[model samples]
Target: MAWHDRAPDSFTATLWDGIGDVWAEIRAHPFLTGLKDGTLDHRAFVFYVIQDAHYLREYARALAVCGARANDVAGIRMFCEHAAGAIAVERELHESFFADFGLSEADVAATPMAPTNVAYTSYLLSAAYGGSYAEAVGAVLPCYWIYAEVGRELLAAGSPDSRYQRWIDTYGGEEFAEVVSQVLDAADAVGPSLSEADRAAAAHRFTTTSRYEWMFWEMGLRRETWPV
Candidate 1:
């Protein structure tokens, strides 16, 4: 009856299914729902983009770390390419949005990390530095998997806002889906060999990051900032 009790052959599938409720919450979150409906505040969306630009810098570094630590050359190359591709996407996407939002290079550099952004990126960096290859992959998987899923869902439902539609199409497109598949395959490769304890640890990483994914949307909706 519990979520994780359902049998799945692949550990990645199992981990994903176990977090069904979390995914549901994400899909229904007002931030995302508003985006779908073209009702979300423009300022909030801009804030999300600015914070995401900040997050992607650290995320690329984390990917590079994972690539360096991978045992197989193919895994190393895949991760490294993903890392580079992530940066390239970040630059292109954010720059495209900058004129729309009147955001300059200095403005982006001056923006502080929101509380959730700090927490999410810090957790990922620590995981990459301290955890095994399996755990590192787990920690990073949700960003790819969740975004891809959300992108596809948004595309299907259709966004009235061109900006929102562009965001959705980028992740929902074939190229990004291929990247997500590669990451999933990489996780699957390392997962089977993990000890039970390590596997559980990896699942925990996946679940925690998934929660952060939800909080990230919430953070954007609120335009969250530190109180102190």
Candidate 2:
């Protein structure tokens, strides 16, 4: 029922292949490569997590919109459940990071969304709110897909830093992989039913968000801020 299950030149497959350049850049980025090797600065890691916490709030909302737009009970359940799961994981995992780093909730609350974070979340929310179901799926898929890809790869390298390992293990583990596989299946299931216009729109949404996926890492590395 998922892409990997029945996939042969599937929609998500094309989406994945189309982003080869971006995907390669993501692999090569120092922030990510450092994550695999465990040399990533703890400050940058914490900064990334705080920004991710902010991003997840809106992302969870977009996911709910995906549920709302879903044509079937299965899609509805998947998005809604993951919406809750996103928040739950954030609370458990991020809080552990904060505790280990001596950060209070106030510290996380005071940290602002970097400019790119704003732009990226804004794009996701816009697509979710304004687009068709296929478009919404496209908007949200990169986050699920890219993180799983990166996390699995990083887990293989097995970061020496226990903290990074927790992050990698969460994304790379069988459970998370199952979730991603389900989403990919959902994309394939819906692809044949969409109109040409909607399919094009979905492709555009997917490609754009794929770029933002890369920008997110740059944001962490640079601690991006508003220039003004």
lDDT of 1 by residue, 1-228 (tens): 112122368878888987999999999999999989999999999999999999999999999999999979998999899899888975799789988888898999999999999999999999999998888999999999999889888888889999988888898787788778888877877877989999999999999999999999999999999989
Global local distance difference test of model 2: 0.89
**In candidate 2, what are the lDDT values of residues 1-228, reduced to their tens digit?**
532344556888877777889899988999988888889998899999999988999999999999999999999999999999889976688889989999999999998899999999999999999988899999999999889888878888898888999999998888888999889989999988878788889989998999998999999998888999
Give the Cα lDDT of each candidate.
Answer: 0.89, 0.89
Model 2 residue 172 CA deviation (Å) reads 0.8
Q: TM-score for all predictions?
A: 0.95, 0.96
TM-score of model 2 relative to the true fold?
0.96
Which portions of model 2 show Cα errors greater than 4 Å? 1-6
